[model samples]
Target: MHQADMKLCLVLLILLFVTLPAQADNAWQAWREGKALLLMRHTLAPGSGDPAGFVLEDCSTQRNLNNEGQQQAKRWGKLLRQQHNGEITVYSSQWCRCLDTARLMDLTTPTPLPVLNSFFAGRGDGDKQTQALMQQFAIAQTAQPTVLVTHQVNFTALTGIFPRSGEAAILALPLTQPATVLARINTP
Candidate 1:
């Protein structure tokens, strides 16, 4: 091969290595700047749908997080702290699993926000719930980077993307425009 060709190849390789990390840093910067919101699905909870006669006030009646989920939540908290320098505010659904996942993250104490509650299980409240969340997000105060720990139903309603439990979508919020997804982050 020609020396010039080899030199060009080396330059391309260097750019490839540098460009990828720069892009990743930009994503994190947007998140840290509060220009983006992290919408996260609650961590693993075994079983589907609640059992018969489930009650909102009774956690025993609801499906709770499994052991793996607990660990996953904790890991997410650690990662966020490391990434953001310990500045994170988490809002979570009132459901047991959502609350548990948020708490396990070990960030600031999770606030139970009704808007983040799941409308799944044939509740038929999807539209109402989604509107409430949108309104709340629009007015939310941005003192710190925030994460909302909710369910798959809410994630789908907001972003039209069905996220797995424990996954997060980073979205950019503009006051006059609809939120746009900047990236999707998954726990490693």
Candidate 2:
């Protein structure tokens, strides 16, 4: 074969043999294998903070998700179910936006977790809350992928990563050890 033709064939072989395998071995695979925690910030709420008289039980009083945010949440749910074959566990903060996002998902109903609640806007104890979440993550079984729908502050406090609205951070569990970020699933 000609030298140029041989080089072209070699390049194709490298792409198929080396690059393909690396692409196939993504962080999603680790999440699918139950080795990571999917930490998701709630979708766009259309405001910086809640209103003056915000109430946890009443969504209208809080900075709720706008139409676009609702659609974003649904799309994420669809993508997650499609990718994981409908195997997922969703835990969410009690905040209206977080709960709405979780409920819109196709996964299991989100159990209200105070630990997952946002500390932003002076809502609660940031340090204690983050520690509580870490403790649960450290001991909980990881046989099935777990999704935590929370806020930016909670995520930052736990993983020191500030995810964008509707974004997700894949964190390796066992809080006693140094945290490892496996992936960052951006908005769809």
Candidate 3:
């Protein structure tokens, strides 16, 4: 990344942390009512992007989650279990880090959704992926709580919020154009 762009990203991260949401109740309430869609970035994987010769089919070729990330994911799962009772459909990106994060949560066998896949290495069209994600539940998967475990780029494309790893944005229903921002969560 360019120095200037890197600095800008750092600034944004600082701002997001500084403005972390205080109304945890409201965010939980939306979840309890099954009126929100959670879009979360996968937990920490040490570095920024995948290494050279990054292969999608091989976990060793990707950035997998670290021990700290594993702990964070487990904590989130326990917390979610405490907060929302009933089934939670977890949709994960095809990336190893994302899949592992979702699996560690144990929130259900996370269904791999292509649209939730990271568009970071020019792998997919961000705009198109965002649209597909929004339309994914237009007819079904609306009655239950759904969580999309994905990458920072997917969340940014959908909500214009550059979410930190392990951060989440709870979007209001009908996740189409101009989706509502219900809450922002920095999960453990």
Per-residue lDDT over 1-188 for candidate 1, one digit per residue giving the tens place of the 0 to 100 score: 99999999999999999987776677667778877678899989987767787788899999998988999899989878877985788999888999999999898889899888888877548888887777766743366788999998888888888888788877775311235667778854
* Model 2 stretches astray by more than 4 angstroms: 1-25, 176-178
Candidate 3 Cα RMSD (Å): 8.4
Clashes of each: 0, 0, 0
RMSD to truth, every model: 3.9, 4.9, 8.4
Error of 3 at 39 (Å): 1.0
Residue-by-residue lDDT tens digits, candidate 3, 48-99: 8789989989999998999999998998788788877799989999999999
Better of 1 and 3 by lDDT: 3
Pairs that collide in candidate 1 are: none
Q: Estimate the TM-score of every prediction.
A: 0.83, 0.83, 0.83
Worst 10 residues of 1 by lDDT: 172-181
Which of the two candidates, 1 or 2, achieves a greater lDDT against the reference? 2
Shift of residue 34 alpha carbon in model 2, Å: 1.2
lDDT of 2 by residue, 1-188 (tens): 99999999999998888865454356677778787778899998887868999888988899999898999999988988876985688999999999999988767788999988878877899888877888888853497878999998887787777778999877776653335776667887
